[model samples]
Target: MSEPFDPARWRPAAFLPERDVRDPALIFAIAVLCFLACLTALGVIAGDRAAHGWSGQLKGEATVIVRARGGETPDAAAARAAETLAGVPGVSEARALEKEKAYDLIRPWLGDVTDLEDLPVPRLVAVSLDRKRPATATVLQEALKAQGVDAVVDDHQIWIKDIRRAAGVVRLSGASIFLLIALAAAAVVAFATRAGLAARRDVVQVLHLAGAEDNQIANLFELRFARVAAISGALGAIAAALTGALLRLIGGGAGITPALPIAWLDLLAVLPCPLLAAIVAVVAARLTARRLIQDL
Candidate 1:
């Protein structure tokens, strides 16, 4: 036989049940948003790295188009320009590309041309610059002028500026996307809190009349939903990190694409997601619960 219940030993049932039937749906939706946010953060980091890499490569080199003059052969003019550019203080090395290299550059436009030597094709010179103190276009051009070699220098200044602008755009776009996802997650939690309060109106009324303070009622939902969001965040963050790792493994050291190389370190960007999710949930749940509870 069961013992009789004593008033002193009786404990009240929780205002909200330990688990709700609708929580799984809420968790799934929030988790998907968190996953997308993490991926966006990782992509932003990788894209920034790629843009910097391309810019650095362009900055450290220049090109020259050599035009023959005053009875000089194309090859002789190119070699003279290369030697002149090599003597510049900031230039590391300068070499004239072979005729075949020039043919490959123009073959697409000119179609098949077996007797390419007859046409007055200008020669090209590739210049390597010193990393610590690279040569500028004006300096290079002056050096060629001093040697009486007619050539044009392309220092890639225009290309580098464009790449930097692209990187800034990528960063701005990523931040906007992340903010949108966070707002979406907060909205979901707020709606869920409101629905939960509406469904348990009678219980909330009884608790309020029984001397439970407004903050106490709000705190209960705050802690409960915060825990749920924290767990969901972990799930989503783990999934995103795993996807990034797979790309890193598949691409090996080079990464999935040259433009966006996923690094193992980039996966760490998702680490703070759980805490952020909890904070958003706490604010959302507390505000929603208090507003609806006060009306009752």
Candidate 2:
């Protein structure tokens, strides 16, 4: 009987360390916070896509209006101008607007646009461009001027500028929200680390006096914290998914619409957020343990 082979001297204490972060309540709280942060991030991503979709779908097409030169019978000049534009190299298809359709467009602003039809609307040609469209506004304008009608190209680029500006603002706002969430997570981790250190103060002191190395003590804290955070993160991500699904169901039932919907794809994209939160918590715990262990 070789002294009964006591293994306590060589092996570290199993689950007897100061921080045994296997608590269910703490884990649940951490998970919930992570899920909320991810939800906000998903909203930001969806907003960005909607802005780009609106801008891209409407860009590159322009409207051309051929106005009569005011003195002569306007029909011949308008037709000649239309014929000239249709033959231009960049112009793919040019169609003169029917009077009814033109009147309908002005109805919103002028009210009873049928009365305004007699007021010269200038023969409007909606121009479609081919792949290798010429830099044709100036060329077309000059050509139309030669044809005795004043022509103007309305390229619709002003809306593009506005859309880009709006998108930039949305991106900046999303960045701000992400930063705030990170700060909140850091704060939570800091608070949790401090509480954990306080709880295990006596255990840490006993271990320090027992000749256990500082690294070993720190390792115990890191392990406990990491395990707790991983469990919490997983729970939080799952809860978040459930909540998002519920909301989507409710919205669908009501036939509600948003510029962007909360889809499973976005939810999947954000699934890693909780895991990142856990990593942040573990790092915070490690740093806290190192400092406190040194003080002891």
Candidate 1's displacement at residue 73, Å, is 3.4
* Candidate 2 segments whose C-alpha is farther than 4 A from its true place: 1-13, 16-22, 69-96, 127-149, 243-258, 261-264
Model 2, 163: alpha-carbon shift in Å?
A: 1.6
Best by TM-score: 1
Residue 243, model 1: lDDT of 88
Every model's TM-score:
0.87, 0.76
Each candidate: what lDDT?
0.86, 0.68
Error of 2 at 6 (Å): 13
Error of 2 at 176 (Å): 0.8
- By summed lDDT, the worst window of 10 consecutive residues in model 2 runs over 253-262
| Runs of candidate 1 exceeding 4 Å displacement | 1-15
lDDT of 2 by residue, 27-56 (tens): 666766776666667667666766666666
